[model samples]
Target: MDIKDLLQTAIYQAAHKAIADGVFADHELPQVILEVPPKKEFGDFATNFAMQAARGAKTNPRVIAEAIVERMNETWMEKAVIAGPGFINFYLKTDWLYTMLADVLTQGENYGNSQAGGKEKIQVEFVSANPTGPLHVGHGRGAAVGSALVNLLKAAGYDVASEYYINDAGNQIDNLAASVHARYLELLNQEIDFPENGYHGEDIIDTAKGIIDREGDAYLAFSVEERLTKFKEIALQEKLAALKADLASFNVYFDVWFSECTLHQNGALEKTCQVLKDNGSIYEHDGALWLKSTAYGDDKDRVVIRDNKIPTYLAADIAYHRNKLERGFKKLINIWGADHHGYICRVKAAIGSLGYSPEQLEVLIVQMVSLYRSGQLVKMSKRTGQSVTLTELIEEVGTDAARFFFIMRSLDSQLDFDLDLAKSTSNENPVYYIQYAYARIASIFRQATEDGITLSEIDHSKLNLLTTECEIDLIKKLGEYKEEIIDAAKERAPHRIARYVHDLAGQFHTFYNQCRIKGVDRDLQLARMGLALAVQTTIRHALNILGISAPEKM
Candidate 1:
């Protein structure tokens, strides 16, 4: 058990005892707010339980605080006090923290993982960008966040499936094929005008020339319509392949690549529409098919099919969500860009119309990332094909730096990715700072082993000698790991974990600067080595959770 759990257990027992003593009306346990004290003198953990209990007890909060403080009797309990505004602060004994190293060594990488998630079947759909072009920096940020969130959820004991939605059956495919044809014509010394909305990137020219070289004149025999659709399908498959390769290079692999074209091919789209029609959630108006999304808190009714009898993209989305539910995913999470905020309500309304509760679906909209080169925004040119791509950014700065930089901020908060800062791979980079701390400990351990130090034979009682304030501070921080995981999981905020690893690294660095681990008596060396080993274990586990690598050497 972790510190938060330990404190919660005590709070529950105290609340129950107070109820038995007729100090409160209902059996409802009062709210317990456990937080680290602002100053080191305040102790390890502090709670404001008495301030909340005073209303029920009809007395001064300080008296209730004193009453609760008088009841704590665990072995770790060192002292308790009632501070200003009636808060009960806990100062834990040093011995209690010394034993935590045993748990760290025994658990290893599994130190922070827990079974508290209750095992829900969750599907996280993210980075479902169109395959018409290479992914940009915006997509990279989403990829990092989505991958890290999946790992965080899995560590919390949820059964998670990661998915990437492919938007292949759309007008974008037609434009892409036309662009490729125009590029091919240009390559053959024949003048051809590209369509107004065709992709103009140089990559399209290369792909077109490749297709012409491989397929020769075989496409000439087919009719115009047949040629266009076939070329579009082939180009889309190629595009998806390239995307998969790029993501693989970044260490992001999805379990599913659900194609929008699949829904249309299998008649599932039409069938879902019929279900909505039969359920009275859809109606006809002005020769157009409309869904009554307004009944479920949507801003207004939306058209599923236009008056021209062509289904809109909304119709396809409804079918896709229905397919997700049909596959037995108890929870569906979509990581959408913030620009799609308006789509959330209508989609949830559609889910409700499809016989599933709106609660089953969740949408997390990540804000945009502002790209800065030397503290200046890089303007995307309209004519020149010099837009920044994910591959380009990764080439400039390695994948590790890109991934860490992308996830360093909250998803909802707009991020400013500094190119110069990310390119610097030294300790100036926060990623390297954490990795170097782990590396430093690994180096020390290797030196200790080579000097004939045997960690396994170290006596357990010697661990109690780690009574320095800096050492105990680190133990207190380690004790908060479980709570950090729970908070990140519940809040759907993986950035919190990233921030936590940096702070832990900072604590380890401070401890390293203030003390020496080796070159002492055998017993002192063993105790100090145990502390260093615990720090190494924590840094490794934290980096693993974030889907990052902790190098053994700088």
Candidate 2:
């Protein structure tokens, strides 16, 4: 059970009893807000219920606080005191902590999961990068954040679908085709001018060579137009395969790889524009169709179809979102790069104009990531000459460190990924520090078994022996696992889980230092062992949510 929630309910009951007892016959109790005190001397948890009910009581808050404390029937509270401004503080008895430890051990991997979301259908679309190049560190960060958010939402009982929108129908694809053709000509000693906007990565040249190995100058037998189409088709397939392989290696898998070309082929864009016209949200001027997005909070009107009779990218996006809503999802969440911050208003406006509440769509902007090695910025990728690819970063540091570091900070804040620190196995590495705690607990269990002690023989009744400050603090932290998961899911923030695991690990280390398990009295040793097992179970569950591994040996 959530002790804070339970205590809040008890406090409300006390206030009700005070009202029935005629202490505040004229008052209606306000909602109770429970908060942890900054200092231990203040209490375990503090609430402002009495202060909020003062107006209804027509008396000073301290009077109401005293009345409620007198009527309180909290069996788990050691004591309750009134602080300045009538804040009620509660110190919990040891039974609550003991019960929490048992709960963690019983729940095991399902410790933090909840049914709070009621299984609302939600779709998270992220890392929809163009299929023109390999994914960079920025894409990697987005992938990590998106995947972790999916796990968090599922743990909170939301029905979620993860998607990647492939951009394969635009000028970028044409440039890719031209670039590959240029490389093929160069390989055959035929002079050709490379397009200025063409892809220059070595992977493009490699793709061209692979085509030559298969066809062998057969492309010369066809017209340049046909060759361009063939080349575009070949490059798109190859790039998409590589993208899928790289993301899978990083442990990110998508339920859907939605294609932009499908939007045009199926006439979804035209259908969406017609819907906007029917709603009078679109107008035509100068042979171009424009959307009055400014009517729905956008800074300015946006063009849906240009003078050349071609639909803009914005047109396709609107259709995509409409498709998502029509698919019966209650909410749509998009994770975009920080550079797209200005794009959020227009998208939300479009959704609003499509007759849906703007609040139905949520956009999260992932800020840029800078890589540092030995205190110096690593500017360019040796392969692409633009930015370091995600594959390179994963190869340099293992997948665990790469995924952990990418989300170690808030999504809106700029992140500096230190290469040297990530590779270190020492305690300075946060991932290693958390994993080591799990490993240490495993070592203790192994040693115990060797000494002819098994968990089955442990005495759980002696748990009250764990009254040390460190031991209590560790159990209290374990109790917060469910709340952490709920808060992270509600806020759409995965970094909170990472921060929680680190704090839990720190508490376990402190408890290990202050308490002894081996060679202690039989009852005391078993109690501590049970606590250790609970800590291990909780840490593993948290790491699984973050998409990080909890190793038995680090």
Candidate 3:
């Protein structure tokens, strides 16, 4: 159970009773409010219900606090203290803390999962990078955030679908085909000018050679345009396959790969345009079809179709969202890079004009990831193949460390991923520090079982032997897991989980430094053993949510 939530519920009950007993007027309470005192002297959980009730009672806050304390049951807490100008603080009994360990043991890996989001269907679309080249560090940030967010929402009882949108029928695809064919001709020792706006990455050349080796002469005899169409078809699939493999290794799996081309093929784009046109949201200006996105908070009108009749990227995106709504998702979350911040208004405007509530869509903007190696910026040039690829980072630092490092910062904050720091085998690497806490606990448990000590043999009532302040502090933090999961899911901020795990591991490390578990006292030994198991379980669960692994040993 979540102790904080439980305490909030109890305080609400007390306030309600006070109102019913004519101690305060009705409708005076603020629904619910709970806060932790700034100092330990103030107590574990404090509330200002008395301050809220004072205006209703037409009296001072201290008088209301005294009367409420008189009515509060001592069974729910050790004592009630009204100190420091009428703050009603509740100090839970030590027995309550000891009993909480049983809850932790019973919940185990599910200690923090909450039912806060009910059963809403939420879709998260992220890392929709064009399938023209390998994923770079910026894409890595989105991958980490999106993957972790899916896990968080799942834990919070939301039905989440992780999705990727492909831009396969766009000018970018044409450029990719041209670039590949140029590189193919170069490999065949033919002099040809590279296509304008074509990809220059050496990886593109590699794809060209692989394609030519596999499909020789069947494409060589065709006209350049025909060959390139096929070349792009082949190269786009190949690049997307490689991208998927990289993401899988990084522990990101999507529930759907929505094709932008398929939407156009099925006439969904035209249907969406007609919906807007029938709603009078479109107009013809300068022989070009325009969307009045500016009417719904967009900075300017966007072109849906050019004068030549080719649909713009925004048109495809609008239709794609329409398809998403058709899929029965009430809430849509789109995670984009910081550069796409300006695109948010247009998309929301289009969704709003489609008669769907724009509030149903949530946009999370993930900032860029800057690579630092040996304390210097590492420049990336796709043409030179000198930039760091997501695959290379995974190979160098291992997937767990790479993911942990990438998600350590908030999405709005630019992440400075230090190559040197992440690869270190020292305490400075946070992933290792958390894993070490679990590993150390695993050692203690293994040794305990080797000496014929089993968890079933320990008595729950004897848990009072764990009275150290450090022990109490660890349990207090463990009690916060449910709240953390709810906050992380509601905010779409997975970095908070990383931050929480680090704090829990830091407490465990401090406890290990101050106390020894294997001793002559059996009850103390069992209590400490249980604490170790709790830390191990917390570390494992938190790492699992972040798509990182928690190994029993390094």
Q: Which number leads on TM-score?
A: 2
The lDDT of each candidate is 0.84, 0.91, 0.86
Candidate 3: clashing pairs of residues: none
Task: Give a tens-digit lDDT track for model 1, residues 124-162.
Answer: 999999999888878988998999999888888888999
The TM-score that candidate 1 achieves is: 0.95
Report the Cα lDDT for candidate 1: 0.84
For candidate 3, which ten residues in a row score worst on lDDT?
24-33
lDDT of 3 by residue, 411-496 (tens): 99988989898988888999888888888888777888899998777676777788999999888888777788988899889999
Clashing pairs in 1: none
Looking at model 3, residue 118 earns an lDDT score of 95
Give the TM-score of each candidate: 0.95, 0.97, 0.96
In angstroms, the error of model 2 at 97 is: 0.9
RMSD of 1: 2.0
For residues 512-544, could you state the per-residue lDDT of candidate 2 as single tens digits?
Answer: 988998989878888899999988988888888
* Candidate 1 minimal-lDDT segment of 10 residues: 20-29
